[model samples]
Target: MNRQTLLGYVYAATGAALFSTKAIFIKLAYMERVDAPLMLALRMATSLPFFLGAVIWVVWKAKRDGKPLPPRRLWISAILAGCLGYYLSSLLDFEGLIYITAQLERLVLYTYPVMVLVIGWMFFGGRITWMSVLGSAVTYAGLLLVFLKALPEGGHDVVIGTVLVLGCALTFAIYQLLAKKFITVMGSLLFTGVALSASAVACIIHYIVVSGGVDFSASHRFYWLAFGCGIFATVLPSFLVNAGLSRVTAQSNAMISSISPIVTISLAVAVLGESFTIFDAIGSAMVIAGIAIFAVADQKRAPAKRETLPVEIEAA
Candidate 1:
């Protein structure tokens, strides 16, 4: 593989691995008596500084080079991206985890690539290849296996959690679809930075309005855990994924991101004392194999091209 392609894989893999820890961190924070809202607020608050600095540096560099700023409308689009990706999706995911195992949550969230594929096909005139369909079938079948295995123990909570997680996956898919356009205009770092900062603001506002105000009286250990989520799980992975997206097609990156659930499940077993069954192993294997097949299948989809009008400039 060329250097950029290889680096794209590396970045996507690393970002996925890091993102897997988000559930673990949120679960850990809960174990320390930190509610999801409080944990999210603190995590986003801690992450804001780094993203803000990135925005400043990029803007300053653009000015120094005598480049004109992007259209002001792009900033509004960035805020909307944050609302879809960071704020709403994460809110649903975190709240869902209150009633579900980390393993099941990861499995449900991994359904997003299928969502992306289908949504793109249905709404954007993208073609749906048989290989993609087969891959999605295999992936969902595996998830069903895992879910059925866990269902006997989880009862009603499982149903509620699944619905919430499905919402999370849907919103996340929407964000990814939009981002494929936004990133081309605003650039990844600037787009990511602006989106992150906007999400941070939205999070802070939501926390205050919902919880009355921020509470800073948590224990030091909880503080450390929250910081870990902000830095390791949030900031680092966001940049890596953006970088990967810049270098590779979203299809390739989606395949590379299959590593995330695998890592999360393994870590859940090791660290959180979650059960690991034969179903887990088989299901995980199926999901990975499906992603592999999908990646290869996408390579054959290059020739059915059709002429299309340019995207509207207002998309910026």
Candidate 2:
């Protein structure tokens, strides 16, 4: 591979690893009894300035190049993508985290690749091949094993958490579908910047409406955790992966990102003192296997009419 491609792979892998840390930080924030809305608000609030700065720069660059401003429709897409991808999905994930282990949460959330495939087939009239179907089946079978095993110990919490995170994955898949178009039109940086800005605004508004207002007197430790998540998990990894994706194929990015669940699971076990198990190993293997299968299936499928989902994976 060329240096640029190799660098892209490295960047993608590193960003994915960083994205895996997002859950860990959020889980840490929750340990402080920070409400899900409040935590999300803090994260988005902390990151908003950065996104705003980037948006301004993008617009300035466009003006310098004498390019027209992005249309209103594009802005609308950004807003919707932000709300669907980050604000709502994040809120659901956080709520679920309150009830479940981070390991399970990561594994569940990692299924978005599959979600993308299925949702595309269902909504967009995209064709699904047997390989993709089998890949998804293997993935879910592993998920079922891990999930069922989780059930015996956590009981209702596991089910509730799984449903919530599943909601997160589903909604994010929707965002990916929607934003893919916006990205093509607006470019990754502009689309991502605008979407993040809108998501931050939505997060702030949602928090106010739902919780009445922010509690400024919360523990400083929580702020640190939220800040870490805002930068390390949200902003940094996102742009990093976006940059890397610009240099590499989506397949390469996806394959590199497949390591994220393992990263999250290992971190959860080592840092959070979560238990590790044979079932966890088996299930995680299956999830990875499924993703590998999906990637291969995607590659082998007829390409002329595939309607082009980008190789760009979300670092959100």
Candidate 3:
């Protein structure tokens, strides 16, 4: 791989590693009976201060350089991105985790890429290649295996959890695609700041509505961990991924970042003492293989096609 590609791979790998810690932290907080909305509110509240600081610094630097501030349209986009992408998506994810195994939860959540592709095809006239179809099939087959295994052991809650996780995945996918539209105009720091702030506001509202009031004293440790999760897993990884995307193709980034599931499952098994059955292993492998195939096929089909015209020809 070229230097830029290598850099992107490193950044993406870092993001994936950080992201893998999300489930572990959530599980830690959940063990204390911290409601999902409360935990989410704490996370966003903690991260908001840091995100705002970054925004201030960025804006000041731009002004120092005599650059114009991002326009109102970009800010509006940022608010929507934050509310839906950060707040709603994360709330659903944590809520879903309450009902599913950590591994299963991660597996379902990672389906965002598939959702992105499908949404693109439906909304933007993008073509869905045969390989994408096959990859999606394989991925879903893996998910089905896990679902079937859980159904017998988990009873009714398993189905509910699965549906919740699927919703989380869909919402997250929408966040990604919609955020892309504003990234260029607002830039990453500004976009993230606005979105995260908006998400924080939404989370606060949800927490109040669900619990009747904010209860900060319920679990100090849980809140602290949730705050750490927001920083380490959410903000830091997001920054890394955005930086990486600037240097590499989405396919390469996706392939490297797919390691997140492996990390999450391993942590679940080792730290959480959760057992990984044979079927789980097989299904996980299938999911990884499907993602690999999808990324490789996409790269092959869209190989960096760049052309340069002669100066004389360009004048015409």
Candidate 4:
């Protein structure tokens, strides 16, 4: 690989590694009796200052360099995207984790790429080729295998947890689509900052209402771990993924990301002492294969295209 491609792989790998810690931290906080809302609220709130400061610095530097800020409309999209993508998805994800194992949760949530394809075809007028359909079917089949394996051991509550986590996945898919739309106009730094800020505010409000107040006095270690989640998992991974996109095709990125479930499963077994059965391994393989097929099919059906329309035509 060339220097750029190597950098892309590094960035993508970094993002995946950072993201792998998410379930670990969530499980950790849960062990501390920190409820989902409280944990998510704290994570967002703690990360806010850094995000805001970064936004200010980024905006200032842009202005100093005579770059134009995104219009008011893009800011509105950013806020909505942040609310739906970060706040709603995270709330559901954390709650679902209470009922499901981290490995299972990641498996269900990893269905977002398939969700993205469906959403794109349905809403954005994107075409769905035969390969896309076949890929999606295989992907869901793998998901079904994973779900079946989990069900016999998970009891009735697993069904509810699965639905909630799937909801989180859907919401995140919407967030990705919306972010793709606005990222160019708003610029990644400013856009991510604003979205994260909005999410943090909403989470804080929800935390207050749910808990009757905020208190981190019980354990500073958990709070610090939450901060680490924000920095390592959220912030750093996000930066790396964006940086990686400059060097690699989305297809390549998707292929590399298919390894995330395996990483999560292994980590769960190692760190959380969760059992890893043969079925778990088989299910994980199926899921990764499904995603790889989907991505490959997607690339074949719809190679990336450059827009010929003027900026105004493209603007919403």
What are the lDDT scores of the predictions, listed in order?
0.78, 0.82, 0.76, 0.76
Alpha-carbon TM-score of each model against the true structure: 0.90, 0.95, 0.91, 0.92
| Residues 1-316, model 2: lDDT tens digits | 8998788888889888988998899888888975888888888888899889888999999999999987998888787888788888888888888888988888888888899898998897777889999989989999998999899899999999899999999988888887777777787777777878888888888888887666544688999998998888888888778777777767767778898999999999998999989999999999989988988888677442312232232334
Preferred candidate (TM-score higher): 1 or 2:
2
Candidate that scores best on TM-score: 2
Ten consecutive residues with minimal summed lDDT in candidate 3? 307-316
> Which candidate model has the greater lDDT, 1 or 3?
1
lDDT of 4 at 303: 77
Candidates by TM-score, descending order:
2, 4, 3, 1
Off by over 4 Å in 4: 304-316
TM-score of 4: 0.92
Per-candidate alpha-carbon RMSD to the true structure = 4.7, 2.3, 7.0, 4.5
Clashing pairs in 3: 82-195
> Worst lDDT window (10 residues) for model 4?
307-316
Question: How many backbone collisions does model 1 have?
Answer: 0
- Candidate 4 local Cα displacement, residue 159, angstroms: 1.0
